[model samples]
Target: MLNRMSDHRLAQLNIAALKAPLDDPALADFVALLDPINALAEASPGFVWRYVDENGADATAARPFGDDLIVNFSLWADRDSLWNFTYRSGHLDLLRRRREWFTRMAAAHQVMWWVPAGRIPTIEEAGERLALLRANGPSPEAFTFTDSYPPPSAPPTTAETGTPETATRAGAGLTPPRPASPSSS
Candidate 1:
């Protein structure tokens, strides 16, 4: 499945905009849709990691900005894996019916970024990154596909002879850089 190829790791950040308080009785429906999709993804090939709440909840704090809006957050392995689950896999089936379960967002409600192979970013950090993208365009710390950034731990570097150990693949759909070595427990 898509997850297998995604074993290398990446992050797919997601946000869902909720409907007006008076109209948002579909929270149950939202969970129903996501729970299955999440299961499928976890079972998929490249499924390395995901972000969950303190109790290992499926969804974290549903930050309500107003009576009409709530923001949700999640992290995934890679853009391609997420893409498969989102647009090409069974999840897409629900996406086609999103209006029945979700509100029409006024802006781009989700963004994706590449994190180091095993890093599990916190929600606060995710929010900061999103805000940075909104406020400062793109840099190594926060960026988007249109103007990508490298993972903060390391960006492209060159040898003394200037032969880059890493090359700039920013904005070219490259996976985030992996650490020089894996961590030992």
Candidate 2:
């Protein structure tokens, strides 16, 4: 069992369904931004680790979910660190433009939980968390930005958690842009 108080970090795993094949020209812009944004995340204050594939690329083609889905699993110092890198960094720009290259997922596409500080989460573990979130909604075990929970040591309170209203307003600037017509080249 992992203990929250003993150097554990927050882990986030998000899966996105591609609107078009990554090589498609319509998604060129999104693909182009990957390197820079990933570099930014790695350099961010709270960043600990990010899953990379055999090609040493960001796990964009890793499809533990399916061939059309991509996974981004990373570890951060804490919730605030992840939040800052995600919302207060260049990552937000890509997030805002996601609809152009990714489909709107009807199910929960993102899930976050805590992990032992240096322990990286396996794809199976990430999948389990995503499933838990999809089936049970937000909980300390697995949650989202809108419905966050505190670490085990902290008391669970609305004030401490990121409620839907607050998350919506705070992340408004990062909302995905309107969908664009799919293109192959």
Native-to-model Cα distance after best TM-score fit, residue 157 in candidate 2, in Å? 23
- lDDT: worst 10-residue window of model 2: 162-171
lDDT of each: 0.56, 0.82
The residue pairs that clash in candidate 1, if any, are 3-45, 3-46, 4-45, 4-46, 10-77
Cα lDDT tens digits, model 2, 1-185, are: 11123367899999999998989999999889988988999999989999987677668867778999999999898999999999998999999998888999999999999886678888799999999999999998999989987654431123344322212312333333356989999
Q: How close is candidate 2 to the true structure, as a TM-score?
A: 0.77
Q: Write the residue-wise lDDT of candidate 1 on 141-169 in tens digits.
A: 66555665444333333334433243334
Off by over 4 Å in 2: 1-6, 154-185
TM-score of each: 0.62, 0.77
Give stretches of model 1 more than 4 Å off. Answer: 1-8, 20-28, 60-77, 137-185
